[model samples]
Target: MSETTEEATLGLIADIPPGFIHAFVASLSVIVVSELGDKTFFIAAIMAMKHSRLTVFAGAISALGLMTVLSALFGYVATYIPKIYTTYIAALLFFIFGLKMICDGCTMSEDEGEEEFNEVQDTLKRTDEDADVESQTADPAEVQKRSKILNVVRRITFALFSRVFIQSFTMTFLAEWGDRSQLATVILAAAEDVVGVCLGGVLGHALCTGLAVLGGRIVAQKISVRTVTIIGGFVFLIFAMTTLIFE
Candidate 1:
């Protein structure tokens, strides 16, 4: 019985898809850092505060799954395109987005500025410092009544799958212009007699986004959304500069 059980356990382990490990590791690190203080987490927290933790987690998981599928599809296309060009293109896009963030960071519209002042004034009026508060705090019981698990699950499944395919297509199409990871995947796929690049890419992205979702929750507790936004913008600028310098 023991011998048979040992063999069975080994077989189960072997049956586990190899890409699963790689995907989990790569996706986790990247998503966590990127998400540490992202809009998605803010959304999740809002959901949690207003509804159930389950609902918030479900939505977050759905978003990450969708992102994974998109990355995977892009990875598949990366197999076809020439490697050198792919990196350059990805770098360029990052740089452009980063520059936009940097530029936007400098501007503060009159209405927006006044709105912020009012928010600060409100914060100053807080009678309880020990209890955290915000501009939007929904009652969980009320939100839970409106948040149906079955409906959310169905919606998430459909939205995540559809978005993944669409986003993947866009990324892959852009990759034709140039992306390093795309190029690397193409080379690896050709040499290793494997077509796992898409899976790896998906996994990488999933891991990263998952982290971001968690981060959004953590950061929301300590600072204002405006502060988080600035930090995110700064990070994007750094990524943009890195892309420009290296590419």
Candidate 2:
């Protein structure tokens, strides 16, 4: 029995390709550099200040996981197509997203500034309300009734976890579309082990996003979003040029 069990374990381990570790390291390094100072990092930090840190981390990680899976799938499909064509497509997307981020960082309209301010104010107000609710006292029966009612409201509005998850998922997903990280994932998937690439990419995203959530207000205060965006944009552009030159 022991021999059979040992054999089974070794067989499972052997199922992973020998190249998987290399693929994972490559994916992790590329994604970490590409994603640093990206818009989504700032978004995660901002959301963390207003929502539960665990929820924000969970949502951001989940969104990145989903995006990695999609990119890997797309890369797998690209394997069926010509490699050169997919490389070109990935390079083009990286360049476009880089340019767009640079432009956005350089320009911010008054309306956009006002909208951001209003959002901050609303978040602060909500935080106060949450504190108040927690501090308020009532009869046990009343508290029970209120809890029931709040549960119903949460169900209807998809508050708490659902709200945070939906917001984070949508924002991260939309922001990631055509971004360099996703393109890199596609490129890596095409060139390396798919499972390893996905795992490493997801791990990289989770680390960055979790740090952002934990840093929260301190990070927001210390780093300007525009500066981060510009840095990320240049990184994307570099990745694009490297891909074009090498691949």
Candidate 3:
């Protein structure tokens, strides 16, 4: 038993090289590039259009942070386990995420989401037009005051926040469960500096999610869901094949 424990400890130390900065840069670059056209990019952008941007960012960043931690922990454990176990598990994760992305892309209706966004925008426009017509008899300052109050209330409600937060969190959390960037983070941490990998991963995800939430609505319209999914799927499949080949 002592011999087995010592061997595992030795395995853990054997893989970690002495370059924290190298791990940080490697992880940051890998994740940012890996997630550029990822499914989560569209999800964050589209959801921002329908929900509060702050809340969506909150939920998304929160989910990503948690997922990063989970990956780092898994990678840390992988260092202590047999190499074969890590290889097979990582390969399985890649295959599952890739296949699922392909399936989802084939079945998903991009038009449905687009139509819903259109409906929301149209409703807001009509409401504003009606309000303008109705406000001719009303005091302009009072109307402005009321609008500000309504906005404040909308932003402050716990019920509204909890619902949107949960929706965004659930969507992001599920989307990245076995995602390519996530899988890469896992592998990177196992062989590199764990702290650097964790920090780099969280920052990378934040950058991706932030851009998607802030600027995604316009880009989302320009790109097709199927294209993003297929691209992400192929990337994962390619990465999986490479991992196996190299092994």
Query: Model 3: runs farther than 4 Å from truth?
Result: 1-18, 81-161, 221-247
Candidate no. 3 TM-score: 0.54
Candidate that beats the other on TM-score, 2 or 3, i.e. the better one: 2
| Residue-wise C-alpha lDDT for candidate 1, range 121-204, written one tens digit per residue | 344335234234521376876657656755787588667654333333333244223332333333333322133434454454
Model 2: which ten-residue window has the lowest total lDDT?
A: 109-118
Candidate 3 lDDT score relative to the true structure: 0.73
Candidate 2 lDDT by residue in tens digits, 102-208: 88777844244234434654664686688677667556788788888797877866844587777777777887888878877887677556898899999999888
Predictions in order: lDDT: 0.44, 0.73, 0.73
Better of 1 and 2 by TM-score: 2
Per TM-score, what order, best first? 2, 3, 1
Model 3 CA lDDT for position 163: 67
The reply for model 1, stretches above 4 Å from the true place, is 1-38, 108-221, 224-247
* Deviating ranges (above 4 Å) for candidate 2: 1-18, 82-161, 220-247
Q: List the residue pairs that clash in candidate 2.
A: none
TM-scores for all candidates: the values are: 0.42, 0.58, 0.54
Q: Total clashing residue pairs per candidate? A: 17, 0, 0
Better of 1 and 2 by lDDT: 2
lDDT of 1 at 138: 60
lDDT score at residue 221, model 2, on the 0-100 scale: 54
